[model samples]
Target chain A: MEIFIALLKGLLPVAYLICLWFYGQLFFSADETKQSRWAKLSVAIAVCMHTALLFSLAAQYHRCPLWTQGEALLFLAWMLAIVHLLSEWSADTRRLGFFTLGPAAFCATVALSFLGKELMLDAQYRSSWFIFHIVASLAAYAAFSLAAVLAALYLTLHRKLKLKTFDLTFRKLPPLDKLDKLSAMWSFLGTLLMLASTVIGVWWVRRDGLHGMSPREIGIFVVLAIFLFTAAARRTLGWRGRRHAIWILAGFAALVLANLAGLHGFHF
Target chain B: MILNAPSQPQVFVLGANHLTASVSLRDRLLLDEKSIQEFAETLLKDGVVKELSILSTCNRSEIYGMAEDPKAARTHIENAWAARRNVSEDEIRTHGYFLSETEAIRHLFRVMGSLDSMVLGEMQILGQVKDSYQLASQNGWTDFYLNHIFQSGFHTGKRIHSETTIHEGAVSISYAAVELARKVLGDLRGRVVGVVGAGEMGELAAQHLHKAGARSFLFFNRSMGPAERMAAAFGGESRLLSELQEHMGQCDIVISATGAPDIVITREHVQGALRHRHGRPLFLVDIAAPRDIDPLVGEIENTFLFTIDDLKNAVSGNLELRRQEAHKAEAIVEEEAARIESWSRALGVVPVLRTLREKYQAITDREIEKWAAGQPPELRTHLESLGRGLLNKFLHAPTTRLKQLGEQGDGSRASYYADLLFALAREEKQHGD
Candidate 1:
């Protein structure tokens, strides 16, 4: 059982890397004016690879699959990329695969790096409420990651257009209005998930009353607060264009910093 | 068959276009019936030409001719144009391009197909060139070879345009005007359009406007007759030249294509129309050569005035797209031309192959007759049959090779084999005598 779990963990990163490379080649070499059949096929393969990795991790751990810090982050990144990839694929925006798949590959590599030892099975985390809290937090982080990608693309394209340097890359990007609307859409969904995750975390804290205050919970709460504030500003203050782009980038940066410090930094 | 026949007749084209000459110069050089007759008569009388035809359009004037002596014919045609148009010989000679033989044939095909037009791939030149050919034919000005070449040129031109997307989009000023109007107005249904002049350009613009679903059209011209005729033909109303301003105020779009020397519509006239329409957008299309509308009228709010230059800018982008399409069209033309050439060359080889086959079979028949002469009466027939079978086997390889060569357009082999077969038949006849 241990050997099969180790093999599965190792195969997950390899599969992710293959998916990333295939998607990059498919999108980067595609003709901008016409649909690419090869790109679609590559994306379909990548989706299957991601699904296989997700299933292997879930089956091997025999729990909610977020027991370890690396597993939690990796699961979150995989969920983010898969959700975005499926949505964009259905929308026929195959170009988004390059942005979303790259981060998923990075997270998968990080998860693979922690693959040698079995995760510490915490009896405390076996509770249904705790599992729900972890899942909601990770799912929220995944949604924010997708929003950050669209925000980054919007800023890049807006800068290029302002500089009056039209190029093939710019031409291949979605229109500024479309990118803005897409970013706002993801940000709205991410904000809602973050709020739900925060509520669950608070509820778990109130119900257990055994765990002491820690930097990880504080970091997650601060990140969630920032995302909620930015989403409100985007809607109420009518914050858009370059200003919205900056806020999105700042919120994503904060989340990354919190995740790294709370989860990956202590382990390494 | 004659060996080493002289090469076929050569062709030459000399012409000037809008780029090389002004509209005035082009119009002056344009040959009418009397002029073409006089020119043809002069050439024949002076013994300076073999065969010739003239093609003239708003953009170009060209003379296509065949000559036994190209140098003398070139000099004679240049001098003749100089005298006719009252220009210096050097001036006429410098602007005109002289293409001989294959180049001339290629130029004729290009010109008839509108590849050489100022607006590349415009369809008007094909009809114009066809008209010129018909006129030349009626005048008894062209011989058999010239007629065949012109007819083939027309056919090639039609094939190139139809089989490819070279003439798919708007390339001319009139077409660009219509395209811009459609873009600005979104849709032309229930729109009233006013045509300021009843000239050729105005007629074309009105036709496009009508096709775009403009409900009512009003025509105004310096002369009432042509305007009324155009309006009646299109199921529209005609307004008097004096009511131009009133019509301009009422119509949703105004297409001005006049030959007026000065600006016909001033800024004040447009401002007055804008007020009467209560801020509704008005599209003004000025397709006149010298520009009929005042250039300043474009500045008025709620009114969009597009002169020829503005239309040209829009057309310039589309011209790049047309150029790309033209490359595809050229590929199609090259393929078709090769197919035609191969077919014509194959026709040339068929007769020689037939003659060679007939001579070989005759020799085989004679040999069978001689072999069967001394056999027993009943056995003779069987012996002749055996001889015929042997002859069929002997001829199979050469016959297969000849047929393959004919299919592949190797006329050289056909001539060589024909000569050998003829020699064999002659030698056999001599030995028997």
Candidate 2:
């Protein structure tokens, strides 16, 4: 059973990588809209395959699982992609699939690399509050991922239009104003979700009698504060266009740095 | 079918115009409602012509008809015009020009296209030609051939206008004068206009000015009655020729259309008017052939004088520009004409080919029926089917080859194949009989 679960987990990253390749081709195609739709379908299939692998691992372990670093990474990546897909579906921002799916494949591959060894599971993680906190935090991160991609495309297209070197691809992207609106809306939702996740983490830590500030917890708070502050600055100054795009990139970069440092140091 | 060749090519065009004839002749030949109805009845009763139409306009009178013979049709038309005018046939025929079929067809095309108008490219002639044809159709004088020819001519005229820039600008002195006035003045709405003569040229210019939105029209002529008539037609007031200088001072634009052998509006007359009026721009159109307005009068401040030569020069210049654009349009017309001609020729060949095929099939059926009568009853059905199949198989290749040839350029070769096929079908029929 362990062997079968490991093999399935190994196949999940390859399936995600295939999806990433299809999406990359789709982005470069002349008929990008048509290719994007095809990419969405491929990603949906990849998500389903990854979910099945997660289920197989859980079933094989015969516990609530979440032991190996590989399993933890795989679960986090899967949750993030699933949350992004749901958000995109609700928001109708299918163009973000091209950018978001690449990172998703990268996370899946990294998770697969850490797939073999068992890790010590935190006792507090079994609590329902812990589950809600982790789920909300990952979901918030997924929305931020989509917001970053939109901001990048918006800035690139805006620059091209300003230079009067507008090509077919730039024309296919949503107008700059629409991109800004989407970015702001997604970040706002992500900040709210992160706040909810933070509150839930505080409740879980208290119930489990954990001591002050783990590196991962501190990283989460710092990243949450960046998003919250950026959102506030955007509202007050009416920050938009290039300025807004730069701040969004900076905020996403801070979150990535915090995640990498915390997750790698904690081996999570 | 009895093939009796046509007796003679009978073609006649009776028309009156400003050129080669005058208004007297045109008015004389103009058919009133009763006369037109009577003329149609008489022509049909006498068998004088098989097809006919009377095209009447303000400037010209024309009778187009096909008769048993050209001379007879010509004589009938001449007598009709003479009878209508109560004049001798000799008097009218001497001035009338008779054209043959080709000349008549080209003339019809040109007339419908407005190339034959007193003012070339005048749009009035197209509507006039259509109305004339409608009248003939109403009188039951238009036949299949005349209907086809006239309709095609009308279409050709439309094609010429749409495809070429030939009619792009005003072609007459009167219209060019109005066009220049409008161009200089922007809009003529509610502007006062003064006319100095009641000659045909001046009357035309005044009429165009009034149509362009002149609110008050004041006419002055040597004869007051004609001036009164002209003013009333345009809803304007008639002033005495003595009051012309006073009216000219008050008017925004002045048009001189007189047959004066000398300059009618001298430099002194215009300079006096310019003093009475606060320095306002005055547009002067002199449409007389012999120059009615003095050329020196243009030296007066705020006065713009346009002579007949100047207007004609503008007309000719615009006509040249239009001619260039018209060349481009002509290319389009030629392409479309060729396309339509090809389609028409292909359509004409289709019925002949169908008949030829039917004739061959009938003969083959007859021959097989004769051969089947000598066979046993059971074998007859089988033999009939076999013969029909064999005959179709034999025809398949040739029929396809003929259709392929028909699809190519100069499909007249298909008609020759049709004739050969018909001959073969006849010979087979004779053998079977």
Candidate 3:
């Protein structure tokens, strides 16, 4: 079982890399639509492999795959892949996979690099509510990451349109308004999930009678506030286009920092 | 049973296109629906062609047919076409080509795939070809040969479109404008389109935008008369050019082609409009000579400004891309034409196969009679069945090989070799004697 788990952990990044390569070929090739079937098959295979690996880790560790930053990152990569597949399915835009899956594969590789050194699961990982908190928080992060990728694409396309550089990349991107709307949708979902996870964290801490909040907890609040403000400004203040995309990207950066600064300090 | 001789009908096309004839000549050669029907009926009645279909468009006039004598048929078609159009035969012969067999099939494939079109990668030719085929089939002017060829042509065209990026982008200026609008604003439905010139260019731009599903139109001209007329035509409101800035915020796409000598829409004007736009991006197309919108307006955030030169550049770039994709389409056409030719060759050996089978059966029957005569009734019947089964088993591999050779474009030689190797004709002659 240990060997099997180790093999799966090793293969997870390879699967994602294959998925990313297929998607990249589909996006950058002249016969763009012809590669959709292969892209879909690779994505399905990689996602399934990632899912099995996560489940195997959970079963072996006797807890959710959220015990450490590395495991959490693997879980986050899985969520990102799932979200990407869902987004591609909903929007019928498979070209976005190149952008979405690149970061997903990178995260998987980085997570794998932390294999032998970070196998020691924390002893403090106990209550079911902690699983919920970590899962929701990571899922929120995945959504924000997707939003940032889309925001970056939006900015690129925005500049391309302004510069009148009607090249292959310009042709491959989705319409600007559609990208904007999709980015906003992901941002809103991330804000809601972040808010829910924060609420769940406070409830868990109170029920357990934890004394004080960590700086990381305070950082999460700040990131959550930034997303909340982004959503509100987009809705009420009519902040859209460049302002909207830049704001989402900034919020995602803050969230990344908050997570990195507190990589090993998430204890209830 | 005696089989009729193979007809050996050849597929052929005689036509003139933009490359071969001037516009006036092509226009003169145009045949209306009724005239095309008359010409098809006459040719069919005269037995000049076995099957016929005529494709007449503004840029090309083509006659696709199958006949026993392509040279005579070509002459007949040219003469008839000239007489119908009241043109001289010399004029028709000078401008048109008479291609037969594989060349004809290749030409038809190219036509259906839009590689032969005046505007490369345009999709209208596919529909025109379909309409012509449908018309010919409905009038009983087409048979299996013509039907298969046209169907293959359609399939090839569809494959070329889906497999290559030939017809992926807009080619014309007005359509390119609408494409830019779509790229920037997503769906054009319910988007307000502001037309600033009310001239031919503006009308053309508006027409393309409407075709792209933009229903709301705002027409502005230096004078209110033309603007109102244009607005009424598109079922939208009209305004004077002087009041353009006041209502510019209402439009999502603004196409300015006014005849003003200097810059009519300044950076400040767009700045004022963007303030009221609430972060919505505005796409402005200045198609006027000397430009209507300020160049500095393009530098503003959330405002995408394009001039006539930009759109022209896009059009040229798309044309170049189409030219590259046309190479892929031509390769597909060549492949499909070769396939059809191979299939046609295979078809030519059908009679030979039937004759060979009949001769082998006769030989088997004679042998069964000669050997089984002395056996008991049951034994003789068993011998008969065994002899026939042996003959069939012996023939299976050779028959498959013969058909394979035929499809590989050696049907005539294969047929000759089958006759000599099996002594089929000699056996038949000896039986007759």
* Index of the highest-TM-score prediction: 3
lDDT against true structure, model 1: 0.70
lDDT, candidate 1, B1-433, per-residue tens: 3222133345677888877877777777777767777876677567566677887766888888777677788889888888877676787777667887656776777777677778777878999888878877887778865787788777877776655445654666777776656544556778888999899988988888888788699999888899899999788888777788776788878989888888888898888886667435577988887888987887665466777776666566567756875765565556544544444445455555555566666777787678768777777778667767876787677666665675577766665665576564354455568
Candidate 2: where is the Cα deviation over 4 Å? Answer: A1-268, B1-28, B46-48, B66-94, B168-175, B192-207, B216-354, B357-417, B423-433
List the candidates ranked by DockQ, beginning with the highest: 3, 1, 2
Which lDDT value does model 3 have at B101?
Answer: 95
Which pairs in model 1 have colliding backbones? none
TM-score, each model?
A: 0.46, 0.42, 0.92
Q: A1-268 in candidate 1: lDDT tens per residue?
A: 5666566566666666665665565455432222245556655665566566667767766765677766676677677667667657555556767787778778777766764355575465467887777777777777778778888987787665444333435545665656766777777777787778778767766676545656666676777777777777766665666677778888888887777665411210
Give the winner by DockQ.
Answer: 3
Rank all candidate structures by their TM-score, best first, as comma-separated numbers: 3, 1, 2
Roughly what TM-score does model 3 have, to 2 decimal places? 0.92
lDDT of 2 by residue, A37-117 (tens): 677778888898888878877676665445556666677788668866875687665665667676778778888877766
By the TM-score metric, which is better: model 1 or model 2?
1
Candidates, DockQ: 0.02, 0.01, 0.70
Candidate 2 has an interface RMSD (Å) of: 23.2
Which 10-residue span in candidate 2 chain A carries the lowest summed lDDT?
Answer: A162-171
